[model samples]
Target: MADKPSTPLLDTVNSPAELRALPREDLRQLADELRSEMIDAVSVTGGHLGAGLGVVELTVALHTVFDTPHDRIIWDVGHQAYPHKILTGRRDRMRTLRQKDGLSGFTRRAESEYDPFGAGHSSTSISAGLGMAVASDHLGTPRNVIAVIGDGAMSAGMAYEAMNNAGAMDARLIVVLNDNDMSIAPPTGALRTYLAKLVSGPVYRGTREAAKAVVQKLPPFLHEPARKTEEFARSFFTGGTLFEELGFYYVGPLDGHNLDDLLPILENVRDAGAGPILVHVVTKKGKGYAPAENSADKYHGVSKFNVITGAQAKAPSNAPSYTSVFAETLIQEARDDERIVAVTAAMPSGTGLDKFAELFPNRIYDVGIAEQHAVTFAAGMATEGMKPFCAIYSTFLQRAYDQVVHDVAIQGLPVRFAIDRAGYVGADGPTHAGNYDNAYLGAIPGIVQMAAADEAELRHMVATAAAYDAGPIAFRYPRGDGMGVDMPERGAILPIGKGRIVRQGGTIALLSYGTRLGEVLAAADRLAALGLNPTVADARFLKPLDEELIARLAATHDVVISTEEGGLGGFGSHVATFLAANGLLDGKTRFRPLMIPDRFVEHASQADMYAEAGLDRTGIVNTALTTLGYDQAAMTAALAKI
Candidate 1:
């Protein structure tokens, strides 16, 4: 954008300390500059733009009012923390967001002291902040702990759970309710600002405490009613009845974009006597930038884009995404069966269920950020003979693990889980990586887990999950476009728990579980170049291990390698377990499972991550060669020739 917009005020401040030192009147100018810098940086790097843009003034106000590093500030989900990052001495690293060995898109504890708690998944700020506040109290170091949470995140029960705990313990915690999505309280003018400041100030707090003291002396029956009357009178005007009920001193419905409104209210909040305070700050999503302000959802998570035109830069893809295939295929099945319903945890578009919702408007349920609720809701639907497909990101589905085990799996409900973004997610990194589905779902007894090899496989898996009305079934597919294979008009329901041989060849067998099938085939080609045509097979189901296929490959092939996209305890782990139990690893046969390493791989391109994990073609070929008794030097030499 204009070769990086000039940010004189932003450049002058290296950290929040400098930001605080500036004249109070100049803070608005500083915020403007900060917003510009964030906009430019995100436009280049591509990240959570709208959220960050929305919280520009709030970030500035929080940093200015609170003595951060000493005072803790936790941003829920960390989507809006980019501006916070810039103000907190990470201004220089803004360009490196979500890149390999670069700054994380989400707040990371490892990144800086400014980031006290890391958050990638939604609705964890209050819990983490409360824990920090409790720790601080126990240590006798009472510092202000402010948790900035979005309205979307508040839908999750964990936020309330933390608040309930905080209220019970009377922990000094400040929860800044950044209400940008839902219109909880739209009024943000002078009157609202005045009331917010007045209520949060010492005078109002002291008066309230005195009133409570007078009420406490009354009859026990009258005391409860007196307290309720006081709260009811205030909440009638202020609109925080729910928060007040949860034992939080509620303030605001203030204009978050207005520094004048935010600054004084935050200062009052910081200085006020608080057991647990909820400051409701209402702001517009994508506040400053016109493009984002117009279409906030589109800019929520963007690619590199033009500052003037707001057009994102996307690489041309020949095939549809696996998420789209799942949606389209599900739609195809739903057309035939009216009982089909879809569910998503605040990610209808991300899971491609928005397409399904277009045709079956009443059937698709957007359950906000509550993953646990989404799972159980799907389970409830399934109990009624409705084919409920619960679509959620793999990492997010981890949040509903208990529900998966206790509700779906335990009840033996026929709930279909369409797990999207399974495997190494490119920019979002390990936090968003769908690496545990194969492990987690596989562990649940009677739960059938399948990983798609490509788009066609994803389509078939969707059909398969729809057709199979047994127990809980989950199908995982990686992020990004599929391999450009021939499209099937309508996916045929595949045989459950069956493995298929793709290429028949020599004594070296390369068995793949998921999208790694492409890499395995390429590795087979590489092996063919090395005069070793390996037998390539796709093990479709992770849970129902194909004993017959394993026996055939073990009996025939000298070297058998199992490749999967996820970490250990996945398809590879299952295959290894099957082979071990069957005594297939006894004599001359060597079985090696290639999956993600024990540790988390940082953010990178999918190809880079796969290659790093030894799940790429080169890695697969090397594994085959190494296990065949070839030394590192020999394998290196052989690969170089290929």
Candidate 2:
């Protein structure tokens, strides 16, 4: 009789070797248990629940079959690596996912031996894994290197480039195509169509195998023609003549959830040595749970939720999110104008274009995981006299800098960029944080830039960007909920490069941008109580300099305190450069640029990150008082008023 399946199956199993030690039937049950545990953990912590749940069977099978740590497994985007983390030694610390000092939401090389390659951005896995494989070959220390890439990520040119190169080099790498047919939103484009063809044509595989047997005996000289005939036959059946042309051992569109299918295929590939191989494993986005399967996007990334009800455990708040505000404003504007079209790179919900897409389906474009393509596509639409609003996150837009400069800015097209997550994004960490958008966009020629202070300002900025067809314009807004300000009934555009003075003062001038205005206001109130009246101005435009307003404030006040939510090469840096280049710093006015210091800030709550960067209200106030030569007593008095 077989012994009762050990509790040690879940508990004592820290690594892949331990997992493999269990019976094959036990391993299958372990996959089910892992899925259950993952769902429970994610329901409480609220992370990438769906993707992780979908990859449970695949994850268990891969780790159990392959020699991990030594055998590198590169998870594309790393969102689905929760189960992988749990199976490894990180099971105990899984609760600390995405916390300041805890495990990351995605895979991290530093976190565990399991995570061989770190990834937050998609389409990088294949290249990274191929490099590892090649390096292993060069060192005479051969080991298996597997890249688990998603169907969503396959839309990008870089993934294809990696596949193209890997196929040519014939690197002994295993490429697992985890096809859920979605990337936040449903996948799009010509490549997606090609993958669909690969799925539909099963007969092509048997035909190719039969032809390979014939070609092997064809005296080496006649082998090329037989191979060509097989390739032509495959092209006739499957539209993916492209993959064959690149020379890869393409496998299947197999059931990723079924252990029976996944186990044997993975074993075959692991043992079958030489040449880059592509294993297409089709999966449901949210596999075990019914609710997640129905609403995959909603479950893609979630806040804490009730497991029983499958309801999100949202905090009671009346304040509207910045994303909702942007969506509403886009709908309002698009309703008024026919030419107004919206575009996003696989982030319809994140960028708040779902309503726009629903309202005007023809006008909305969901370019799947292709930032570079989205920017240029928007540029293409703009040239045809259509107003294309490229709604992309700040971090993702960084991928399209060249397109912005060459295609849009150089041509002076009306590509309105709705840059969301314009500051430090919480939980998801540094990779997804929209920190550099302001600094980078400001540097581009023939571009107009603005940062919104609140939801109302974001509306106005969106309108401003839409109306000003003079050139490419971008208005950035932070993540999370707004300050619950009274939103405008109708949208109106603010004057280009003009700043609004929030408060009047005597000694110091506080010039701030975006959400940093709130901090500046707090500091001003604190200073006012200490008998140092500080005037505040919201420098709306980072480019076009707002030179007149900045110059006036500088000449009028003894000190100018510039605050912006970005790093050294950001708004404050630009302000400092302007003051120095314009010869404004040499005189009585001393410019103090309060910006994010030169360092990569770690994962934390946005508030905590702001405090660390000296951009919080207290930090901002203290800096202002110190610049004005005030003691602690004076600073305290200033704080009393605020």
Candidate 3:
């Protein structure tokens, strides 16, 4: 681990109150110190480094000007809240970030009072801040509410919805637009272009300030007309006329890195009167770090690294990641299938569509942080006879559920849903976990849902989705690397709604879904050693429910354990419901469905989380033994042997 950087100025400030006590001139030094400390802390505990680096000055300015814990300050997505966390007295625990029982990578309401609202997703801060502002109004309190949102997050329709609502209400709300021109990937759509134009236009800074000043000095009756005149002229100069029309008192495209520039603007906005106000502050992602600044992604998310060299530490992987496999397979399939096209909601790289874009740039589309738009756009393409694959993360797909139901499922459009990160994603925690997709998507009638047991299986499922044209079809794969299985030349589209048996046994059967097949097979091997060989099968399709295989297992075996890396109402629940409804549970068959517990799992290593949920190898063995009526002592002894 790298040694902690010296932060002499930062040492004195343990809290935001302490920071607020400092003189304005000394704030520059404090901001520099904060950036260094953030870099050092993230060097030890890798996380969202570039975003935090970008927000150092803005965070200091906000904390210094506003009263936190009392005055609400919400960070959209919360990836940029590391500096906020340090200033809010979490510096001591900074090194333990994103670990088991440690500081969360994103903001958590339970973690600190300063983090008024928890966030791990984007475009929520403004709505939440507006709600707080209205609540304070109702309570007759004079507290200020500020929401800091990035430009990339602005692409989502929800941000505009909140802005429209806040504008209409004329609420006393402050929204600081952190236009860093980046959000994981380079931003897309007209919003990014408008922001860029706003920052680059020479008339934006001086002309807008002069207009505000001139309008303030005019007579009370003429002030409204003069302000309107200035807004029309400013719209010709800068592109913020849209914001003005949205009912916000639009402020500048100021320098976010300069405390001198940021402090006064934030202070003025903090002291401003009624009506929703927007202060646009321009920033550079990975501002202070040279390596990150030079990189295309600006090291948006990073691992522990050397401070001087900026070389991040990465664990060596023996196999390709599930994401890469999907990308490669999709690319290969697209070569032969001219009708195939790809769509992603501003996550081209994360969903591996970046690689697809390289091969078939015309076929791939980035819909810009609008999941609903991405799904519907794919549905539209499907209507035109194009096989559109909507590649999205499982967690992010939740935002477009209505579109998935109404646009695709209801119409029975053959839009291929490539759900990446379908299970518990490590570091990112519950907010980004693809835990609920199985349950949610399975409930929709006529939609085919499949979960890959490994990397090779994922390739086949992708092919399967591409080949199937009946209705909406989705295939889910977990985050991280493949199981090092031998690769085939190309994927073979498997029989839809059918499962294949991997191993044969007699007394008990383990029906696995998604990536849990490895652990199930491991448990099967252990049971075989103990003279209790169990049948092992991978139920690839969750929605179609592999009824024949499931019935055969239940009838032949004394016990059947259904396992999946999903929530309570997911694959396991579906299997259990099917078994009970089909009278498969009426005989001597004792069925146990192993799944994620009905509670939100915290940030931990994936292995530890599965163990905690009792879904690990030992956990599965224990469940089988206990279900077979083994005594507590025998169960413990059997587990100990494994």
Candidate 4:
């Protein structure tokens, strides 16, 4: 018992440098302790578990080799940066990971000198590292810039664009392709097969370097011809022929876990003085832990869990989440309509398409992390008279904004966008928060946007998207459970560009959209207590908004308050625009647009997140009272009556 209480490995590690101070035999022990510490920290404060676990050895080796603060190392998506953060000075604060006013889940530039560029979304590392390398060259500071990107992120076009540009400029950048064979889920596309070949093959690495050296040693006049021959040889060997064409001297298919292999190769690449070299390191997701290794995706981003059992600590939810609801709804529709098909960008389970994929494997398209391709592909599917439902997270959809505007909206394709996580995502932090979808998406022409108040409404929205044969339609829902509303056994399509008046009132009208409708109802209850009968209207369709309802509400009610959980240019802003344009918001009529303040919302619990944004019940009541100039005494008395 006395011996169990004290662990030498735990005592020895204070930082990465200290870990590096240990012997080769002791370093493996240190890694074990580090992984244990990570598991312990994350079990208390839930976050990305499998990714960090998978990259433990790579993290250790990289820190052991590179001088971090001097040599820029950027982690793509930053979910796996927890280990990096712990290795770097933030170990003690591991318990505060993703908590409010604590350490961010992703790499933050402001957090420490070690973090070069902040990232949350995937596939931005290579481009950022290239910029750093170019800047380093220009400033006469030749520091090594490294981008460690996962295979899932490799699917995004931005990575290719970055690789293309970096290869063209011949920037001194080292891209570590951490192919764990999983990125959120198993990566998709032709590149995945190419990666599989590279990771599995043995001969690609040994002969390529010798061949490249022979080419370099040739005469200056024969260099171009020799280079082309070497290029053809690389194409034949690695089959990243495209990468060779882009100008990168591709290396690896190296064993990421084995420090013996990784360290030497990294040193060789560092010494070789190559231009924008890609070091493909193959790794297994959830390498050390049996439970995580067995089910990597399930453990990918876990809630607070029991260390012993690997069971989530949180109680099982009574109500189904919006994602599960969407999945079931899509399946029901697909069963009836042969044309209905579902598509996701490497998120079959996260987007709730796993069951759908299982049901109709051929109909489902898991397009890796390529959101742009997913949208355009769906548009192409729609053009051929197939009902394509492009289910994507709101934050990821930001990546495909150009595609949404150009392919789906402009072409008037009937591609259904099931935008999930359209509000404050708690622990994943601001980078993963889906706050701006409505505002940006609403600006697109020939596009219809709808927000569901609950699960039943989401089902209805799905039906609406399916039934509508004209143009693109987007329906957004929040992350968590529904309002316990009874779901329809079968979905029925609702009218396009129309709203439903949930509660009827007299002088004051509350126009709400999306999940904020719940808050509006709460405020309406308070108003009712004040003997102020407020009309509650759900503005279902954002574009081609219920103008008749707005006009009537403006004329009938003494004041009209528009509410939404999105930033300016969202539902509330659009309502304000409509009212102002129609001369409805005059000195006579009081109109207040209650929207999320124009700013970035940091990580916090959903309730705290909403309260901070002033989108809660109390905030709504305060806004109502302020607009009406009601005193505290009057408001309190009114509250008592309710």
Candidate 5:
């Protein structure tokens, strides 16, 4: 455990009410203490560090200025909500963050009254806040609704959509644009560039105060013209005129770290009677910590670390991560294929495209936090005869499903979908889990869906996707390091809809997909010890499943167990459907599909989550033994031994 930081002011406040009671001048000290406490807690827990550090003062100011539980404050992306959580009643559970049965890494509505909206993925806060604002007005309980959205989140179309609607409706909503100039990666798109110009412009620095004073002093008729002139001049020099055109009353590129500036502005906005307003505040990603500020990514997400040195404590792994393998293999493939290009929705490093960008900078595109745009953009690229790989997290791909179905699948475009984090991602919890990708993508016709059994297989899958130019193809892989397999120098594209048998057996067969191959093999070894050798085969492609191999396995084996690291309606469901249609299961061939249960698995270690879902080696062994009519006592004893 990391040494606990002394937080005398923070210790006094257990809830937002206490924070609200504190003197305005004392808030600076409270903010410092709160930041220190958050750092210390996160040092032990290992979650989002930089975002929370950046918003310490902002979080403090918002809580102090507003009646939180009643006045809805929705945090966009929620990675920056750790300080908010601390300032609320969850300070005691700070050390238990992201753990099983603990506080979520992202803001969860069920967890707290203060978190009015749940969020994991970005760019929904404005919409949620608008809904709350409208609801409050309808209920006749006039409460302020503030949406704190990052500049990176503004890159998404949803933010603009909400903004346009809110502006049109003329609802009393406050949008605090937290412009840190960085998301998970340095933000992409024109908005970031515009914000950069706005921050650097002389008009923003010099005339903002003068313009505000002039507008205040002018008559009612002159106020509109004067404000318009100021807006036009600022737009000429900076670029906030677009926001004003959207009908939001735009105010300041204020220093977000300065509580003196943030508090007064927030109080004014809270008290003001007007339509939708946007307060643009500039903040550093890692404001207080020198080491975090000095780091390239501003130490955004971190593992448990040494607080004194700011060195994260990541466990050493000899194996390369699945993400790294994908990046390297894609790079190798791109070297040979000149038409091959990559696209990511603001996750260059998260998707391992940073490495790809380093080698082929021109070939890779970092589209901001816009998954829908990323998909359609890739489809457009594919239409132009370019091999476009739309690399996205499995969970995030859910956001672009309409595009995947309409643009890619309908058009039969050869857009390669490289899906990372294809299973239960630990710590991030159910919201970020890549559980539904297989099921969702499998439901779409004319799309080849594949899952890798191991790192080496991932290489082959990457090559397969790259080579596959017939239609849209997707390959899913898990979150962490590979199973220390010897990687090939170059990947060979495998035959479509093909699978390979690792071990041939008699009584039973284990058909595995994705990373569960290791567990299946382990279970097979355990079954071998019990004098029951089960056949193990890796079903590489889920869509065009190896029907021939599946038929033979079902016919020959007494029991067929299909296993995958995805939800119920995924690879296992597909296999079951194929077998049922073929009349393969009418005979003595008893079938069992092992997958993640219907319920959302909570935050836990990957191993623990798998065990809970009955997908681990022990679980597999137990399932196999029970399916083969082993007695309860015998099964329990066997499982205990395993």
Candidate 6:
């Protein structure tokens, strides 16, 4: 573990109440100490670093200015909520961030009262905060509802939709547009800070309200001109023309890092008589730490790192990552096909499309933080006879489910969905877990769904997705390094709806889907030692089920087990349905399906989560042994060996 930083002021303030108790002048020192403490905790825990570092002052200011737990502050996506977590009496538990049964990486409503809304996904703060504000009005318990969202989050249509509603409703809500990454409105130093304070203050707000009241009394002809003049003057200086048009009284692009600037502006907005207000505050991504500040992508996240050197500890891997393999394979496909284009929702690097962009700059489109737009945008390209590859994480694709169903699936567009981050994502927990794609996509008709069993299989799937221009086709792959397998010269397309039998055996048969084939093979070895030789088959395609291969396995073997790294209604359910329909499960062949359990698997190592889900080697072997009705005495001894 790295050496801990000294945080005397931070140590004193465990909660926002304690923070509010501190003198106004002592806040800058408190902010400094808070920054040091956050850096120290995250250095050990290894989570979202730069985002939290950027919002240290803002977190401090909010906690200091507002009555947190009473006054609702919703952090959008919660990338920058680590500091907020620390200040809200969770300082000691900060070390356990993102671990199993530990504090969540994002703001969870169950975790603390300070977190009014649970925010794991981006661009949801505004909508959620609006609901709370409306609720407060109804309950007659007035409290400030503040939604702190990054400027990048504003790219999503949901944010604007919420803003439009808030404006129409005229709800007493405060939106702090954390203008950090996006260059929406650059801060102009002291002048910008002054304007923000002036506009947010009672004097300016009262004057504006009075003028509006007087304008209402005037003739209907002059109202339009007066409103336009006032809007134009304010928006020109504050750069919030769009927000003003949406019915929000806009503040400034003030310095987010400056406690003095942020404190008064937030206070003004808090005490203001306006129905809805939007404050724009600008800050650096990696505000305090030099390493994150100097690094590219602002060192957004990191593994366990040395505090002094900012050197993250990465485990050495022999095999290439599934993402890189996809990128290389996609690049190869693009080289042959000019029509092949890639699209990502603000995740060029995450999807390995950054490398693709380097090779074919014109072919890659990164629609910022807009998954719904990204899906429909790719569908538009496919309509024009262009092969569009929509590379997105499985978790993020949930946002564009409607687009997948209506735009692409219903239209039968030949859009290739390169679904990354399938199965259990270790530290990101259930929110980021890509477990639903198999079931979600499987439910839709006229679409080809597949999962790669290994690195080489991934290459083939990429090739298969690229080659086929049928309806919509999707292939799922996990997050980490692939199983070390020999490289193929080029991926050759495999026959659809067919499975390959890896090992042929007698009584027991194991049919695996996706990466769980590796675990099934390992379980088969252990079963072989226990006087049971099982057949192992990799079911490559989830959709267009391998009817012939599956029937053969069921007819030949007495017991067949179907395993998948998905929920109940995924590959296993599909296999079970096929067996029941064909009367395959009526005779000697009894089938046992293994999949992720009904509940959400929390943050843990991939190996550990699979074990818990009963999809690992030990879990599979134990399941097979129990299903075969092994003697209790014999099973206990057999279990010890495996």
Give the top-scoring candidate (lDDT): 6
- Mind giving the per-residue lDDT tens digits that candidate 3 earns over 1-642? 556677888999999999989989999998888888888888887998888888989999999989987999999979999999999999999989999889999999999999999999899999999999999999999899999999489999999999999999999999988989732223344454454445333445446677779878878899888877877765554457878899987666666787766675676666556778887777888988898788737388898899999999988989899999999999999999999999999888888889999889899999888999999999999999999999999999999999999999999999999999887888889899889999899889999999999999998998898899999999999988999998887889988889999999899999999899999999999999888999999999987888999999999999999899899788888878888999999999999999988888899888888888878888998899999999998877876775
In Å, residue 523's CA in model 3 sits off its true spot by 0.3
Worst 10 residues of 4 by lDDT: 1-10
Model 5, 346-377: lDDT tens per residue? 99999999999999989999999999999999
- Compared with the true structure, what per-residue lDDT tens digits does model 2 show for residues 1-642? 122224445876888889888888887778877877787777767899888888999999899889988999999979989999999888888878888898899998788888888899999999999899999999999899999998488899899999889988989988888988632222234444344344333444455567689789879989998777766754453333666677776665566777866776687678767888777777888898888889999999988877767898777767788889899998988898999999999999998999788889999999899999999999999999999999999989989899999999999999999999988998898888888887788778878889998788888988888798899999899988888789898779889988878888867999999988877887777777677789899888887778888888988999999888877677888888888898888889978988876776778899999988889888887887788777989767656666
Error of 1 at 93 (Å): 1.0
Task: Residues 192-263, candidate 6: write the lDDT tens digits.
Answer: 789899999999988988999999999999999999999888888889899988999899889888887888
TM-score of each: 0.99, 0.92, 0.93, 0.91, 0.93, 0.98
In model 1, which residue pairs have backbone atoms overlapping below 3 Å? none
Runs in model 6 deviating more than 4 A are 296-298
lDDT of 4 by residue, 266-321 (tens): 76666656477777777887777777889998999888887878887665677789
Q: Give candidates' CA RMSD values in order.
A: 1.1, 5.0, 4.5, 4.5, 4.9, 1.2
Cα lDDT of candidate 2 equals 0.83
Best of the two (3, 5) by TM-score? 3
Off by over 4 Å in 5: 182-230, 233-239, 296-298, 640-642
TM-score for predicted model 1 compared with the true structure: 0.99
Could you give the candidate ranking by lDDT, starting with the highest?
A: 6, 1, 5, 3, 2, 4
Model 1: per-residue Cα lDDT over 46-125, one tens digit each: 98899999999999999999999999999987888999999888888889999888899999999999999999998999
Indicate the residue-level lDDT of 414 in model 5: 100
lDDT of each: 0.89, 0.83, 0.88, 0.83, 0.88, 0.90
